[model samples]
Structures are given as C-alpha cells and as structure tokens.
Target: MLQTLHRVTILGPRLSFGSRPFSVSSILRANRAVVYTQTGDPSQVLTTVTYDALPSPAPDTLNIRFLLAPINPADINVVQGVYPAKPSLTSLVEGHEVFVGGNEGLAEVVQVGTGVSGLTSGDWVVMTKAQAGTWASSRNVRPQDVLRLPRADGLTEVHGATMTVNPPTAYNMLNDFVTLEKDEWVMQNGANSAVGQAVIQIAASRGLKTLNLVRQRPDLDDLTRKLKALGATKVLTYDDLADRALTKTIVKDWTAGKGIRLGLNCVSGKDTTAMARLLGDDAYLVSYGAMSKEPLSLPTSLFIFKNLTTAGFWQSRWYKTHTREDKENLMRTLVDLVSQGKLKEPEHEILSIGAEESDEAAGQKIRDIITKMSAGQYGKKVLLRFEGAQ
Candidate 1:
C-alpha cells in the first residue's frame, strides 16, 4: 500500500487512501541532481536528474539538503572511474540507480527521524566518510554517515564545505607522522596547493615553521607574498630545490643548526627525492599526493645513513581506521582554530546554482568548470553553492 502510494504520488497527484489523507512528503520540484551511472569523461557521462518530491527521513536516517560542495581533483577522478573507492550504485532513489559525483560537502538537516539523537533540523553536518553521494539537492543518510558540525554561525559556506578534507589531512599528517617540538621545521612541496596552504596555517598555529616549495610560475613573487601572508616561514620554487647554493643558504639561515624533522611531499617524482634530502636524521617523509603523476626516486643513502623514513598518508584510509569519536575530536580542534581566526581559509571561486535552474544548464556549467580545471586554467579552488549563500 505504501509502495503504491509512493508510485501514485511520483506519477501524478496525491491521493487519499483510507483514513490517512495522502500527500507527498517533503519532496519538491526544486530537487535536482547530477549523476553518472557508467563512468567515463564526466562531461559525457554526467546527467542532470530531478525528482518531483523529496522523501521524509527513514527511521534511522536524516533528510539532508546540500548547501555547498567543492571541485576536488579526487572528485574528478571518482567520476572517471579511476578512484580507489567507488560509490555503490543502487536504485534507491526514484528508481534511478547511479553514483553521485562529490566526495566532500556541507549539508543541512531538513528533517530528522525518531532514532536520531544529538542532531536536529537546521543543524549543519558534513560527510564523515567517502561516497556519501553529496552532489545532489537532497539525500537521506544515516546518522553514522555524517558528523554534526558545531554551528553555522561564524562559518562561511566555503570554509564549512572545504574544511573536512584538506584541513584535516594537513592536521593529521603534521601530528600523526612525526613528533615535532615547538619551533621545529618541516618542508613540503606543493606549497601553493590547498593542503599546502592549510599546512602552513596549522603549523604556524602550533608554533612550527614550514619550508614551502612550489612550482615556478611567472607570478612567483606574488605567490610567495600570498603564502608568506598565510604564515609560510620560507617559500621557494622547485628550481631552487636542486641548487647547492640555495640549499646552503637555506641551511645557514633557516635551519640554524636544527634539522627539519618532518618532510611533506605531494608532487612525488624528483620533487619527492628533493624534499627527502632535506629531512633531519631519523626523520619522517610523508607522501600524501602524487599530483605530478610521476614515479618517486629515492636515494639509497638517505635510508641507510640518514635513517630517513618514507610513509604515505590518505584521509580516506585514516577515516576507515579511526573511530567516529576520533574524527569528531580532530574536527572539533580544527574548527576551533578556524573559529579563533588562527587559520585562514583557502581562496575559492563560488559557482552559484539556483534551485530552479534547468538540468542542462546546471550540467553544462559544471562541465565548463571541470574543463577549466582539466586544462589547469582554474587558478582558485572551485566551490558550488546550491543557493545564493556564497
């Protein structure tokens, strides 16, 4: 009877059945989403899917409305079917079984079920794990699938949407890899990247200084000023990595007899080897990303003589191994830092999508953003806002 009622409501107008005055749930014509069933190029495979009504929360679930989502490189890889973890494709919603494309986002609880606790309507939340299918106007997720945020006050959509992934990744990498004393030094490539920026801010807040290295660009000075403003102790180009004179200068001025205890490498390839060479004795070098898509080349002597250690870090893997309490604790710490104005958010460009926009229009706009990112033309991080909150 319930299934028949659902079908009738989805197919046409609401109908009364017996004593219950039948009506559609919380669904509305404003609900729309972008999904892909068969992965390929996102532009070719992604489709704009809309629903006539939003379903009420299940007994163990919360009804969510997406507020903001980001365009991470990993998200693009997920759409291309190249990511390590894939979303489970099922016909759970509107008989359209497909994988939604976002891995991280900030959402609002529109409704809560009887079984849920510690969360209420109008509360802000974020995905606690990957593959939560956040690239939609609305979703029905279980309590364990999301972590409740402190509050929406004093938090921007960009910060709330982006804080979960990069900030925590940077925070954990700094804390989990090696123990560093206050004022100890750490070196990392991709200094201008989002994670890099977060690393700079978080390290500074902890009284640790970072030796940041980024790719050489025409606007190197401008980039250097920006990073320094974000609390980068020292910024250099990749070209400076191979220069003996530059290394000598860095050692003389920055190290001051103390060794860099931690090394962060994201570019991999020769970049990884370059950063590894700068670590102190018995230090750790954590590789979090391979943005260069190149092979890592490690010198044999560092492992034997310097006793240097190389490790890898992935936030998703960490989430799987840790408890929900552990994650929430870390998130609380990070959020406190942001609230205290000790950490700065990364630069972002907001793309607003009205709730009433046509699916083709929305899909094309997303495609254009992806195209820009693919060509490396996008300078700032791209953020998607469902309404005009940006």
Candidate 2:
C-alpha cells in the first residue's frame, strides 16, 4: 500500500507575460509519482507518493502535466535492475528518496517560464532525455529536455507517448544498416511487436516488402490478417520456419531467387538462426532485442561463405550520440508519416488512475497490470493516464 499527503490550496497573485496571464498558485497543484526505493520486481517495489504541490519552475524551465505514459519492456528491465541505464535517485517525496519509473510519455506545458522562448502553455511535447521520470502527474523540465510535437492536431495521445521508442527503432534499423531498394525483400521475427508493426507500415510506404514472422498463437489467422492490413507482405508463424525445405521453398518463391538481403531480429536463438539462413550474400542481420532470453548463435559457415554481417542497435544510444537537429529531423519525418496516414497508432489499452482514488488503490492497480504484463497476458500496449495530471 502507498501513502497520500493532505492537499493544500493557496491563492496568490497572478503574473503577466505579454498577453498571457500565468497564476503561480494555480500551477502549484498536488502531484503523485510512481516511485521505487530499490530496484527489483516492479510489482513488489513500486508505490505511489503524493506530494502537496510542486514549486514554480525556475528560469528557462516549464511546468508540464503528463497526458500519457507507456509501460515498455525496457522500463520493466530498468525496474528489475537488469538494464544498463539507471535512473537518477531523487528526493522529490520530502524526506524519502526514490527513483521514478517511466522512460517515455506525452505531456502538455501548463506554465511557461520567464526565460523560455518559442514554446507557450498548451504545447504538446515528448521527453528527449532518457529516464526523465515520466510516471508522475506533473513535473518541471527545461526546453532542451523535451521536443515539441510539430503536429499534434490529428495524432492521439498514444501516438505522442509512443513516438520516441519503437517507431524510431523500426525506422532506423531499416534505413541505417542497408541501402534497400524499392521492391526489395526484408525478413524479421517478432513481427507483431510495436517496432515490427512500424517496420511493416514504413516498408510498405517506401515500396519495400517485409517477411514478418511471429510466435504461433491461437489467433494466428486473426494476427496474420491484422499484419497484412498494415502492409506486411507476408506473415507466418515460427513453426513454419522449422521445416527447412518449406522455408527455402517459400523464400525462393517470394524473392524469385534474389534472396533476402536484410533481416530484423528481436527474438534471438534457434529461430533467429533459422531466419538468418535465408539471407543472401553480403546480407545484414540487425538484432535490437533478445526477447527469448537466448543467446544468438549463428553458423560461421554463413559468414565465411556468404559474407553475412551481424550487428546490434539500441535507440537510446542513438539519441545520446546524435545532435538535437538530427533528432528533430527524425521526429518531423515520423510526424509527417502519421499525418499522411502512412503510419497508424499502435493498438493499446489505457489504465487510468482517477483523481480521487486512494494512493494504495492506484499502486495496487498498477501492480496488477504489471503482473499481467509480466505473465505475457497483454498482447497490446498498456498506457498510463493519471486523472490528477490536470
């Protein structure tokens, strides 16, 4: 169970900036952050801390209210202390120190600072910094810390919240490793994942073809139809790849003997090696995740004889290495694709924490969802919406 602090209301003089009037006290609203004192099982260590109110932002800072945050697999890994990147510890809850739990979110600027420029209140933004403690009702941030969404009119909060991770990973993996030409075939496993879906749509938009593979599920027919609807050239279960003769036959027929030159892998192990066997000479296999928790073992004969290249990609590292302009360009491109209907919002379910709900209730609700997610029950994304964010 979690603890909640008593709410306090204060009326103070309003400040004026140009034609916009900003109230200092109105911005000083209560805040609740999902935090953990130590890293371990998320359901066991996670709790909510309610603070009376947040202080006004300093110069060059803006106060923001989170609209939506996502519970990504990486976030879980971070909470479990298995990930390389660790969040900075904070004393936001008065005397107690804890770490906030979220990596990606969409927020609205509620109050603009005196020193900030170009952005005003009501603007939508996404964090550029990794592990910025997004699982909170409200927080103050700097302009450089976030990227403003160029077009938010037609996009939903889900799109904005998820824009930073999966979509970019999909896009970058496709473009960075290989110089794929139109009508070229690309192979990938875990094709039903968010990144996989983005790859399908983006490939279709550019006249490229994708051979998507997923684990055999009870709803195979339904999932195949869904992926094809998103522009996937072909969808098959991992079971289909088990038969070497059948896989060879299918690959030959699809590529007309040209052979697949690029493969995207998230599920590593025997299945990935089986998928890699289909790649042509000088082909590239990019691994972004190891969801199967198995080591990627490939035959050295493929590398020696076919000149195959294996590599890894991490989007967080990309953000850290690239310039701000580069990030802005990538984001603008993704936003345009969404606006043009070339990309679609991910299928998701919202887990809302009501404004008047008790802190214990909220914490338990989140833990329940995390438990379900850990058990592989949620096939779609789970988004967090704190009603008290306003």
Candidate 3:
C-alpha cells in the first residue's frame, strides 16, 4: 500500500515515500537492499536482493535514506569473507530475514526515532561507524551511529558524502601519531589514492611537506601537475627509485637534507623497502594498506641503527576505541575542512537505490565494475549510489 502525508517544514518540496511520515509500521516508499548470505567465489554471484517497505522508524534510531556508498577494495574483501570485521544481519525487512553487506555510506535523515535528541528530519548525516548501506533507500539506525553534517556552504553534497573515509585515514596518520615539523618532509607511496590526495591537501594546509610516489601512468605529466597543484612537495614514479641510493637522494633533497622523519607505505615488500630506508634516526614508518600483495619485509638495520618504529591503523578499530568526544572531534574537523573549500573530492554520478530493484542488468554491471579495479587505474573512488534516500 502507498500512502502520503503532508507535514509543514521547509526541507524543500517533497512528494516522498517510505520514511518521512511518522506512524506505527506505516509502510512508506523505501529502498530494499540486496545482500550475500554466504561467501562468493570468483565465478558465483552468491547474493540475494530484497525490496520491501521500510519498517517504522526505530526508537532511538534515525531513519536514513542512503545517498552514495563508495566501493573500496576492503568492501570486496568483506563480501568474500576475507575481511576481519563483519556487519551483522541487523536489518529487518518485516517478513523475511537475511544478512546485508555494506560498510560506509552517505545519507539523509527523513525522520527521528523516539527519544532522539541530537538530530531531526532533513539533515544530512553519515554513518558514525562502518556498515552503512549507502546503497539502500532507507535505514533506521541508532542515533549514535549517525554523524550530523552542517550545511557546508561551499561543498557539494556529493563531496560531503564521499569525505568520511580516505580523508580521515590520511589526516589521522599525520595528526595522531607524530608531531610534523613545519616544512619538514614525509614520504608516502600510493600518492594517487583519494586518501593520498587528501594527505596532500591537509599536509599543505599545515605547511608540512610530502614526497608522493605512484606507479608510472600514460598521463604521468598531467597527474604530476595535479598533485603539485594540491601542494605535493614532489611527485615521482617507481621507475625513478629502482636504485635505493637514488631514492635516498630524492627523499633527502625533498626534506631539505634533514632526512625524512617518517615514511608511509601502502604497498608492501620492496616498495616498502624504498620508503623505509629514508627515515632519519628515531623516525617512524606506518603502513595501512597492502596494494602490492606482498608482506612488509624490513631489514634489521633500519629498526636498530636508524631507530625507525613501525605500526598500522584501521579506522574501524580506532572508532570503537576512542571516547565519543574524540570521534565527534575528528568528524567536525573533516567537515570544517569541507566547509572552508580546502578539501576537494571528485563529483559523483548518483546510483539511486530504486535502480537496484527494477534493473538487474544495471546492478550487475556496477558489481562487475567494482570487482575489477585492482588491475586498472581509476581517477577517483567509485561511489555506488542508492536511491530514494532521505
């Protein structure tokens, strides 16, 4: 059954569905999510999809209409049962039961659940934690799981939606663990990642320097210009670092001969070796990704003589461990950066959630594209859009 209710509030004009009206289990138009109940091998599409009426807004929950969810390599790993963190079969679609798979997403608040004091309908929000199906039409979730976004005047909603993941990964790597000296240089591989781009922006904003590295591409010169425009101190291809001595010289000059105080490696093994060697005495190296499919192999000298320390970070673990106040602060900082026009991400094509139900070919096409990225180059993260959100 379809029903409409008119409420008096100026969140723009609305002929809405599923979630805006507040009533007891009043079915409104909403997106039904598809999920994989079990792991899928390379040849199998072991996933089931459901589109049903959204449930009544949950007490202490914020009913969200998802906008955009980025498809990351980590998400693929989760689907294949390779990732360590797993989202529970937490959603109820009224008649049947199954598990849903999703991690991060952007959304809009359509209604506030009972006793919810911090947010309301029409506000833009993001998943306070992971597993937000930015791929669904509507989600009724705990208020604590929602991060309310201010009306950032300068940024588009698309940029705001995409901001939560990589940007913060880059920011915390620099801000949380070490004190970056002004104009001092840090070295990192994976310089073209969305997080890498954010690192360039945040590092430049703070007057710290970066030696950015990436594999050579056909448009090497153009990519270099783009990174430089975002304040990359230097951009180099892996070909230039075939010799470790050359790598050291390039890094030392970038750091004004103070030697690099830190090395950031997302690729593993020898690619890690190039960065690890550049750290000055007592400097640190941190790894958060493994693009090269190799483990981080370090020599004994760098650890003892150079006094380099190594560690790793995952945003999910960090969120769970931090006090509520700290989580809010990091979010507020990222939002403020967007508001000031200092942080810029690519504009995304919308993938409304309703598209999932009527179009099997379309959904399959998206899933295929998401599964094929490690072999090619992409300019920005592919954000799969969910429709009818908020």
lDDT to native, each model: 0.79, 0.86, 0.69
Candidate 2 shows a clash count of: 0
Task: Please give, for residues 159-193, the per-residue lDDT of candidate 1 as tens digits.
Answer: 88887899999999999978888989989999898
Q: Which portions of model 2 miss their true places by more than 4 Å?
A: 1-29
Q: Candidate 2, residue 181: CA error in Å?
A: 1.1
lDDT (Cα, tens digit) per residue for candidate 3, span 1-390? 433332221122111123333332332243445454455541243232435556668777767777667767777777677788776765454443444556777777887878999788888887767765444556778888877777766766667677667787888999876788898887889988877888888898888888898999899999999899888989988777788887777677666679677777788778777667767887878888898889899899988798888989877878788877787788788878877777876534454444324334434655666556544545556776654322
Compare the candidates by TM-score and give the number of the best one.
2
Candidate 2 residue-wise lDDT, 221-338, digit = tens: 9999999999999987789888989889988998999978999999999999999998999999999999999999999999999999999999999999999899999999899889
* Predictions: Cα RMSD each: 6.2, 7.1, 7.4
Give the higher-TM-score candidate: 1 or 2: 2
**Model number with the top lDDT:** 2
Error of 2 at 302 (Å): 1.1
Superior candidate under lDDT, 1 versus 2:
2
- TM-score of candidate 2 against the unseen true structure: 0.92
